[model samples]
Target: MKRRTFLGSVAAAGVGAAVAPGLLAPAVAQAATYKKRVTGADLDTNSRWQVAGTDLGIPYVLENGSIGYLFGDTFNSPWPEQQNNDWRSPVMLRSAVHPGEAGGIVFDSAAKVAGNGRAPEIMHNGHNGIGIDNLWEVTVIPNDGISFPETGRQLVSYMSIEHWNPGPRYSLWKSRYAGLAYTDNGNDFVRTNLKWFNDADNADPFQMWTMQRDGDWVYVFSVRSGRQDGPMMLRRVPWEQLFDPAAYQGWGWNGSNWGWGRPCSPILNGRFGEPSVRRLGDGTWVMAYLNCATGNIVTRRANTPDSAWNNEKIQVTFAQEPSLYGGFIHPWSGAGANELHLMVSKWTHGPAGNSTAYHVSQYVGSV
Candidate 1:
């Protein structure tokens, strides 16, 4: 999730090491903005993540009206005081819950939901076999798209193994190959069908950030450049072809038309976090992401998924919380001044002092 990893020249097939940056026009003042509303909502559970653990940030409220919360390595508290939020379990966690009508959430402490177990295997070196293979995020697309089943499925993004060493020459641990893990009923995923498109030479070798339906096509928000601390790129494919690489189209600012199978262009500059996008009530698309440098969750609005966006507002900051990111907006948040709910994961100051916590916490209210 750091920015410096995208340094070396890519060896992709014909895409070249240098992709021309799309120049942005002079800015205009924006009207739609954000204001801090909800801080956080904590959960009560034990060490096994039967109820508690960190790394529970990326979430998808299922079409069947349940919440599917995806998490990375979970922290297993060693002490009886569940608040002792220290120590981590090497495996991933997928916790689910039924949203209550009263605005509170309750997850079953007994439900057998074991997230992606162990590391990734498809063409991954994992820092020469030492990095952790993790699935960074998950997306749930309705089955209405073409060639898809009548029932919706989840598209989980995979992050190959990598070592974490933050500093100059941070390209030591690079994410080479990432792809999607398909799921039918939201919880159970088909492990054998894992498909990956290598990002070694291309711009976006990771999961296409957050994807949303923009009219007839599903717009994919992806990160490349510095991987995390990089511009947000745009890609689109018809609803029925969301998983078809050949059907994908990249935004061509100069041509003003989508160039099918062409290279992607930077749509948003600066270090934007993993973006969570949704179509607003007025038809404009709004994306919520952490401004990594500032440690604040910001929102941006655009007329179309692939258009220039106006910086809306900074909603929440990590003044006390520290590494709080993964601002995932709830699908039920329907436009206008209605309340916006974010499923955010923050790195708490651990028991051993400053170690980053990987717990997924929830925040309610609006922007």
Candidate 2:
């Protein structure tokens, strides 16, 4: 079937609703929820160790003999707690060479503030006072590279939504904003200046994924927000034009559409976030993300990154715990074989508490 027609049929049937070529509509909309939950019950939960203490935001990079993760320690407490714990404002980067192995580079700053108090400059705000977190990098094999600076560079501004409480008169509005930047040292590494990818007013910037189709040029995918629906909006932008002021002027294609009834309609009422995309063997793109409402990890596939994606959403991991974050796929992990791995952090009772312990799972068969 043509891609567009397939998508139209899928949307008409409702998310996860099965369809027949010409069957009668059901008396009610199929339950827009998953029936099962996946959690860490039988696995060796104690095997995974903490990469850093006191920091929440985490992004990883895996390559031959090495795995790197970057995170920051700045805590954005809501109005009440903000009065006390104001000292937790340092950012850091760390890595491990082997899969379960551990070791890494740490970068910290002498300054501390709610927003980092730095000027907003650079791609997402590279030079701005915003704390640096949510890191991702592309690697060139044969020779691995990793380094850290005594004084880390400021990348973006972020606010934590987990810190707020809502009242009848005052609504809860919490979010994180990032400015992107990269640099080339006339040698191996090139750093691009940060650009404003988000504003401090709305939702927080959760995680970002990037893919390079041809060469030199790159495209970025981010999990932003739609406040009312509460689902993360998946957005994409070209690397070359990312830093331009006008780049944010018009909406560029990022696979899904904004409102209801479109091919790119928000799934599971918008609570999805932490998205990671991988090109399948057939050249189709598959995305795995957190289904917040059901607290399960689910998978969705698309013929292309732009439009006409499959409406049949599949639940991959059935974690019973509060599984809200961490979804990733490592394409180069096995020899000539693609492997899918997913992680879910355990639920926390409060902002200062640790994330639920994480659980990782591999795909059952080849894609």
lDDT of each: 0.46, 0.31
Tens-digit lDDT track for model 1 on 35-142? 322112233344224333444345454445444444443334422124544323222222343221344444442213443222221122232334333543221211
lDDT of 2 by residue, 1-367 (tens): 0000000111121222222221112122111222112223231111122111222223333222223232222222311123342222223222332222122122221111122232111112122233334432111000011212222212222322222232111212223323333323211122343433434444433323333232222333444432112323333334345456444322232453333222222222334444555554456565655544344455555565544444424344333333334444332222122233333333333466434333222232122
* lDDT agreement of model 2 with the native: 0.31
Winner by lDDT? 1
Residue 339: error of model 2 in Å? Answer: 2.1
Number of residue pairs clashing in candidate 1, backbone atoms closer than 3 angstroms, sequence gap of 3 or more or interchain: 9
Question: Which portions of model 1 show Cα errors greater than 4 Å?
Answer: 1-42, 45-51, 78-103, 108-149, 167-173, 192-208, 214-216, 225-228, 255-261, 280-282, 350-358, 365-367
